[model samples]
Target: MQKIRAVVFDAYGTLFDVYSVTARAEQLFPGKGEALALLWRERQIDYTRIRSMAAPDGAYYKPFWALTVDALRYAAERLQLLLDPALEAQLLKEYACLSAFPENLGALKRLRAAGLPLGILSNGNPQMLDISVKSAGMHGLFDHVLSVDAVRMYKTAPEAYALGPKAFGVPAGEILFVSSNGWDACGATWYGYTTFWINRAGHPAERLDVSPSGTGHDMNDLLEFVRTQGAAV
Candidate 1:
């Protein structure tokens, strides 16, 4: 394999714990927190996929922040929870600064020290990505924080994956694309990027024909994978 020149990560479930909002959610909704968090995440991704499928050219694009709010409202309604404006605002605030995974900063620092360019290719809007990176204390770790909003399309779409190589100025094959979502890994693979699936939950792989070049559970494992790939991280 060509030496990995740049590492691009998916933001939500890979580096940041999207479910970290559950604590604030529990404080507000008591027993429905976990369910709401899970369902909300599901619906958020679903909406992105629906939008992309409905308009591959991004004719139906909505910013990720708006989709997130819509998904939360839908989840709450499905659970029969009363999500008034104030409560909804609180949840959205928490989501804006979701917690980083415990192992992320250390691993990213090591990669950066090795002179490897690191970046984020996420569905988040630029403002959302900036705030989350700052909130997680990961402000200077990445060389780029790319958003699909540029193309107005979400991931699993070729346009979204293309941003990484374009931003890094490298061929897709030389950029190591890491994502926690199995489907996302598959998408990156299909896009011709060397992919790693961070299966943090140990979930089964997607049935998609494409598979990631590697798999692991956390940033530490990602560091090790980088080493094995001939990157001196």
Candidate 2:
């Protein structure tokens, strides 16, 4: 609303398709691949949330890489799947190169063309974000990649969201925080950002008082929102 000077995105579900790991997973686990991916992701977020809430004083912190591996192992145990060391290594390797969404590049280019500083504020560690960004061929698109590891916290925590404003040198209201996760969108909004929710899966909104400034089905819609807003300014 204050004329967005920066567009900070959530990396995993928003830019990179976390589900892309399903290819190798399917090969490893056959018909159970989809289930494994879903459960693994669920556990990953659950672990982060638990850690963040359990230590409000920032006493407990684990890098997302560790949490991701732990989530995969837990998911395998829950599903009664055999995840040998070799198979586990392969799965983690595939995850590091998660594919970007089909429209991600074009939309990002459009935003860049509009002269908005683009950044990423994510739970991913620096190395993980670096690998994923390069692998997706989005090497130079971002002006900043702010990882929660810097603050030893996770999203939905105000400190994690504060990284964006700090990185971009802008107020939260001047940053358009875009996330595919409804809870993330809500969190960003509550953190004072003009948020966008990319509801790619058509999921229901989180039961939070905060609502996104805009909602879209994909990056294409995000591009249009940026374009329209840019024109209006």
Candidate 3:
């Protein structure tokens, strides 16, 4: 196996947690934080799927913030939260400063110090992704922050897979694509990446047409793999 030059990460869920937004929502909306948050996230991803399958080439990629607001609105209305525009903005802003797992920083530091390039291939809009990387204290850690907004499709889509080579200037084979979703790991794996699935949920693998390079319970196991980044031929 060839050495991996750049490691790319999916921002939300993989690196940053969206639950922080809902945790804050507990103050603004009563009794519906968890359910509202779950619904909001589910609907946000649903919106992306609907938009993607609609003509697939319609130059109609909505930004992450728009989806965030729309999903929030949909969830709020259904749950009867009635969040004002001001409160909504506050929640979105709150999302920008989410903290990451302590292991993320230490582990990434080891990778960088080992001279491997690091980048982000997230589904967030560029601005939102930027805030997330920075707030998580990872601004200087990544060589690039690539978002799906440019391609008008979300991750697990072919368009998102294409961004890896475009942003990193390397062929897919040399890029280690790390994501939390099994389908995403498989997507990039089939797309030719040396993939790693961060199976944080312990969820069983979804039936997929492609196989992944590895699957681990968390980033630390990923670090164990990284320690041998250049060891394999």
Candidate 4:
């Protein structure tokens, strides 16, 4: 136990449900909506990782917002669906307000009540985070919502993970980074944070050689893990 002083979360797929946009997407594209949404999300993350690796110096870095839009366009073209201006605007608006996970509020409240400082360190750009957090009614739960846009990089990149310790003003060892993405959990663990992997989809660990300090299926499991950690400390 590293005497955790702060809880830093990954916003997109951890606290918020990225698939929530599928409902609106379904309405617009009929039968292919769900496929589009899934592909778009996958492509969005792939773009971030590819760009981050290709532009380690940040000279060719693209904001998450731009990558998101590009991913959407690519998804549409792949599906052979017409992405007119109006439809694109509607889809983008839906993305701006992704629903928070049902467990997020209660888990965050429990962590806050336990005297831990909570923050969000996300790949989302500032406006995207602001809109999503506000829409999810989670704006007050976090003391800081850090965006990688400031560093011109994405997660799995050390510079992006550095935002957590910088925002909390604490050592990486004193912060617990929680994320639904296994790769991100491993990255945070490598960065020296006590990482918790929220394996909500029951996926296996990433092959990155690093492992999370804890693993759970959901936020309730995270709550219990934190409790046990605090007790041990």
Candidate 5:
């Protein structure tokens, strides 16, 4: 494989704990926070995929923030919970400030010290990415915070993956694409980037024919992978 020249990350689950909204969720719904969070996330991703597959030409594109709201509503209905406008607004507000993984800031700093250009390529819309990163106190760590809104397509779409190479001015083979989502890793791999999957939950890998170049449990493992790839970290 080519020497890893830059590292690009998937933001939502990989850097920010999307489930961190559970605290506010539980406060709002009383007893269904965990269930609500899980279902909301699942539906958020499902909506992205459905939109992308339904219109590969960008005709059906919607901002991730909108999809997230729709997912929350769907999840609430599925769980028989009452999500009125105020509760719905509260959850979305919480989501805008999702917490970062405990180890992420340190690991990212180490990689930055190693002189690798780091970036984020997320399905999130630009405003959502900006707010979340700033709220998490990771305001300036990355060289780019890319959003799929540019191409009106989400992850698993080659256009979305292309942003990393374009922004970093590197070939796909020379960039390490990191994502917590197995399907995203597979998509990046298929798009020719060296990929790493952060399997924090120890979930099974996707059944897709492709696989990530490396798999680990956290940002620390991701740092190790970069070190092993001969980066100065």
Candidate 6:
């Protein structure tokens, strides 16, 4: 196991349970929420890439919410689902209050008490991350939340990967970059940190040129990885 000092985590899929929001969407939207949600998150990521690449002169300010709307619109079309004013409003409102995973808060609390520096390196804007953290009641749990918005790029971009260590003022190798997204993990690992892949979906790693240092089924296993590094846990 690598001796990780400051653990830098990827938000969304890593620690935040996005599915909780989608499932609720199903309940609230009465049959269109889940499909809308699947489309929403996918476009959320896709738009980041679009904005980053079309960096048409320091103008990549496609906020996460905008991307959500844009993606939801497109995803609805692709999935052949209808989106009305009421559905759109509900999705956005619910997203603002998405909760943390069942074990996320406890795991983070335990990790912090165990003496690890916890932080969120997310693709979300600072405001968005703040909302989710507070909704999950994890406002003060993280030492800091580093968003790619600060760098004007998404996590897959080189500039995005540099945000965490830059904010933490630590070496890349000292951070444990955890993510459920393969490409995100590849980006973090490629940047030199030890990565822990929260493979909660049982999916394979991205068919890329690199692999993360470790893969676990859930957050508990991630903590175990941290314990092996040094903490008694």
Residue 201 lDDT (model 4) = 94
Worst 10 residues of 3 by lDDT: 224-233
Candidate with more favorable, higher TM-score: 2 or 6 = 2
Clashing pairs in 6: none
Which residue runs does candidate 3 get wrong by more than 4 Å? Answer: 228-233
Return the TM-score for each candidate structure. Answer: 0.97, 0.96, 0.91, 0.95, 0.96, 0.91
lDDT per residue as tens, model 4, 69-141: 9999999999999999999999998888888899889888888888889999999999889998999989788
Model 1 lDDT tens row, 176-198: 99999999999999999988999
Error of 6 at 120 (Å): 0.6
In terms of lDDT, the best-performing candidate is: 5
The Cα local distance difference test for each model comes to 0.92, 0.91, 0.82, 0.90, 0.93, 0.81
lDDT tens string, model 5, 1-233? 57999999999889999776988898888889988998998999999999999998989999999999999999999999999998898999999988899999999999999999999999999999999999988999999999999999998899999999999999999999999989999999999999999999999999998889999999999989998999888
**TM-score order of candidates, top first:** 1, 5, 2, 4, 6, 3
RMSD per prediction, one decimal? 1.0, 1.4, 2.1, 1.7, 1.1, 1.9
Off by over 4 Å in 1: none
Worst 10 residues of 2 by lDDT: 224-233
Q: How many clashes in each structure?
A: 0, 0, 1, 0, 0, 0
Report the alpha-carbon TM-score of model 2 versus the true structure.
0.96
Ten-residue stretch with the least lDDT total in model 1: 18-27
